[model samples]
Target: MKIIPAQEFEMKRESDYGTPEQNAAVKEIIQAVRREGDAALLRYTEQHDKIKLIAGSLRVQESELQAAYDQVEPSFVNAIRAAAERIRSYHQRQKRNSWMDLQPDGSILGQIIRPLQRVGVYVPGGKAAYPSSVLMNVIPAQVAGVPEIVMVTPPATGGTEGINPYILVAAAEAGVTEMYRVGGAQAIAALAYGTDSIAPVDKICGPGNIYVALAKREVYGAVNIDSIAGPSEIVVLADDTAEPSYVAADLLSQAEHDEMASAVLVTPSRQLAEAVAVEVERQLELLPRRDIARASIDSYGAAVVTASLDEAISIVNRLAPEHLEIMTQDPMEIMGSIENAGAIFLGPYSSEPVGDYFAGPNHIIPTNGTARFSSPVDLDDFIKKSSMIYYSKEALLRDGETIMELARREGFEGHARAIAIRLEQEQASQTGGNDHEL
Candidate 1:
């Protein structure tokens, strides 16, 4: 990791991470799958994943899930169940209610909150299986009262075998209604446009490689999406009081995610910055995915030494990192001043991994500086709201003139006429006249 003055470091744009060629390839895959459906999915699976899919084996059955439970360790299953409980408990508080209020004028306006009928969760399953991702994606939708939740993952070894047992067990524990052994852009297409075997979903949520992200983007208008997520990132704003070792470990947690992942440290202490930099180098040698982490640090990682704590905080808010860690003397005091960040981890004990796995907060957060506008995936993502309006004759008369005048000002003559005719009819009726069609 390189240490530089905060003002000297240039902010990197998200486009610097991936090339146009990569995007174009993802687009081609998405378009092919959209046009060809399951056949295209099978071909991609065979070519990319080296797995052959038989017709009936695409969707996992109850029997297969039971067998997965049998295969996985009992402690792992319990851990998944415990994580699901925590996630469900936390999201239950975010549930919204449909409400309405009656007025003296008899006009009624309200919103109806309803869960999505069905949702498809895409879990990446090739090199690593993300059981925690399964819990994060499914539990919130379940808490939102979604009736059907379908999960899709790349088959373990092509389509000949099933998805990872831990993924299956997590899905079952999270209350998923169905599971499909498909992956990549093809799986996204299958979920967006229903195949003979797979059902279309109202929304799709999860993280994946660049191809998967692009596939979700292509299918966005056809179906709802949580967000166009980019590579993972973390920013730690610390002071001299922070432990250098803890800061180094926390930064490396996100760095190992991918070569595009960014891990940044901002501090007022030059000595602390130097200490953290050394710790990062020493710890980098011990990580299992050191090559990926090294590349990420070389390209995107940095230690920014700010002149003051306020300056460090300014840099943090400007970046608006997906994950923000405050490791100062009083993290809570600084937390109130932070305006941007998908998730805020306070104190050394509250590391990024706590939120990623066992913590009640959802790990599927905005990435690539999108925390400036986007938010973490929550129950609201799996629900919709419908506005309701009603008006009685009295209410129409009470506001008729104002409504007609506004409509006329807007050049909506038909709207003006509609209200005008109704008011005129009411007036005529009051006078015992037969001009009902006024």
Candidate 2:
């Protein structure tokens, strides 16, 4: 990590989002999968993942899922089960029910909340497996009452086993009803446009590599996506009281995630800044993924010295980081000032990994400054709401003129007549009753 003045470090866009070539490649992949269906999926699997597969083999079998349990240690299964339990418990609180309200005029208005009939969760496969992702993405949709949960991940390559056994075990533990052996942009397309073997889902939720992120953006309208997630990121808002080693370790946690991942520190103390920089350099040598972490720290990581902690927090809000740690003497005092960030950690005990692995909150947070306006994957993302209305004749009569005047003023005769005809018929029926009285 390098130390820079706050003014110099505030410059935006430290990383490249994507290239035109990548976008073009993604569009081509999406189109191919949509047209060729299962054939295209298999073709891409061989091309990208270095594995050739038949249509029948695209889906993982129930026996494979069961056998996955046997391959992994009992400890691994127990841990995944424990994590899934916590994740499910947290998300169940976010569940919502359909609501209705009735008025004295016999008119009813309400909202009907319904989970998506089907959903797809994409997990990155091959040598690297993240069982945590399976838990983070699947639990919310399940809690929302999704009927069918379909999972897709890349196949293994270079004579390696197909779909890491741990990922399969996690999916099984999460109660996934269906899964596939596929990856990258093609997998997203298969989810958006159904193939002979795989059916199209109402929404797709999960994270993947750059190609996966770009593909999600491409098929957004055809099928809903959780978010256009980018590389991992974290911003530590520290003070002199913050421990240098703790700050350095937390920053490296995200930097090690990918070469494009960013880890930043903003504090008012120059002494603390220098200490953390030294600590980060010393710790980098210990990381097995130090090459990736080194590239990230060299390119995107920074430690800025601000005039005051308030100024530092102001800069944090501008950056709108994905993860923010308030490692100060009193982390809570500064908590209220933070308006952005996908997840906020108060003290040193609430480290970033706590949320990433074991804690109840979803770790699939918004990244790349998207936290300014977007949110993490939650129960709301898996469900849809439809407004319900039942208007009685009396209620319509009471508000008919108000509606007609507004429509007529807008020069929409069709809209005004739709209301006027009904009111006129009711008035005529009332007049006939008066004639009988006379």
Candidate 3:
């Protein structure tokens, strides 16, 4: 990893990660899938994933899910169940309630919170199976009281048909009612537009590759999306007191995700930078994904030697990494000053994987500097809020003129007329006056 001075590194933009070709390819896939739904999905699956998916065989059955549970080792099943329990308990606390408030004049105003009737969760299954993604996506929707939760994954290759056993087990534990064996932009399209086999969802949530991200973007108006996720990233704001080995390990953790992943370190100590560089090189030798990690670190990762701790914090805030770790002498003192980050891990012990797995915090966070405006996935993602308003005759009479005046000021004559008509009816009902429908 290169160690640059903070001043020199400040000129970089985060969105420089993906090329225009990648974005254009994703857009074409999304448009094709939207234009041709199920047929397009099967064609893409066969071409991209090399898995032939029959229309009827797309949805996984309950019996198949149980068989998967039976096939997996008992110990791994137990772990999925335990993780599901923790995730469910944490998300249950995030559930919101509908409420309304009545004014003295009998006008009611508030928001009615309601969970989406159905939602779709996409879990990447090719090359790597993310059973954890299954748990993270489904548990929140269940806790939010969603009636139906559907999950989609790529069909297994090499005659090993069906979703991964761990994913099935996790889905069962997380209260997912339906499962589908489909992947890529086609899966996103299937969720966005109802297919003969798969039902459309209110919102789709989970991490995916570039194609999935672009598919979500294209189908955004048709269905709601959590956020347009980018490549994984981690920024560690460490001081001299932080252990070089621990910092190196955490940086490599995110680096191993993909070649596009970024792992950065910002500190005020030159000696610590050298130590971390050495440690990263030492650790890289043993990592299974060393080539990918090395590429990520070499391409996007860096260690910046800032002049002061304040300067380090400023650099981190500007970067707005998806994951920010404060491994300093007084982590708490510097934590509050950080205004942007998807998830903030305080102290040395709170590693990134802790949030990824057992920590109960959602790992599907905003990426590519989107933490400046977006937030982590939570119960709010599965629910929608509708503004509620009720007005009695007296309340309407009291506020009608104000409403009409404001509407008229905005050049909205129809809005003003609506309020005027209501006010006239309210006044007529109040006294023995002229009674006429406007």
Which structure among the candidates has the greatest lDDT? 2
Pairs of residues clashing in candidate 2: none
Candidate 2 on 181-298: residue-level lDDT in tens? 8889999999998999999999988888778988998899999999877778999999999999999999999999888789999999999999999999999999999999999999
> What digit string (tens of lDDT, one per residue) describes model 1 on residues 1-438?
899998798755464324688778777777787677778878888888888887667888889888988889999988887877788888999988999989888778899999999999999965567899989999999889999999999887223556788888888888886888888878888888888788799999998776788878878899998877777899999999999999999999999988878999999999999999999999999999999999989999999999999999989898999999999999999999999899999999999999999879899998777888989999989999999999989889888999988998999989988998888888988898857563
Clashes in candidate 2: how many? 0
When superposed on Cα atoms, how far off is each prediction in RMSD? 1.9, 2.7, 2.3
Per-prediction backbone clash count: 2, 0, 0
* Clashing pairs for predicted structure model 3, backbone only: none
How displaced is residue 149 in candidate 1, in Å?
0.7
Residue pairs in candidate 1 whose N, alpha carbon or C atoms collide under 3 angstroms = 51-158, 51-159
lDDT value, residue 360 of candidate 1: 93
Identify the runs in model 3 with alpha carbons over 4 angstroms from their true place.
11-36, 157-162, 426-438
Query: Please, what is the whole-model Cα lDDT of each candidate in the order they appear?
Result: 0.87, 0.89, 0.84
Superposition TM-score, candidate 3 onto the true structure: 0.93
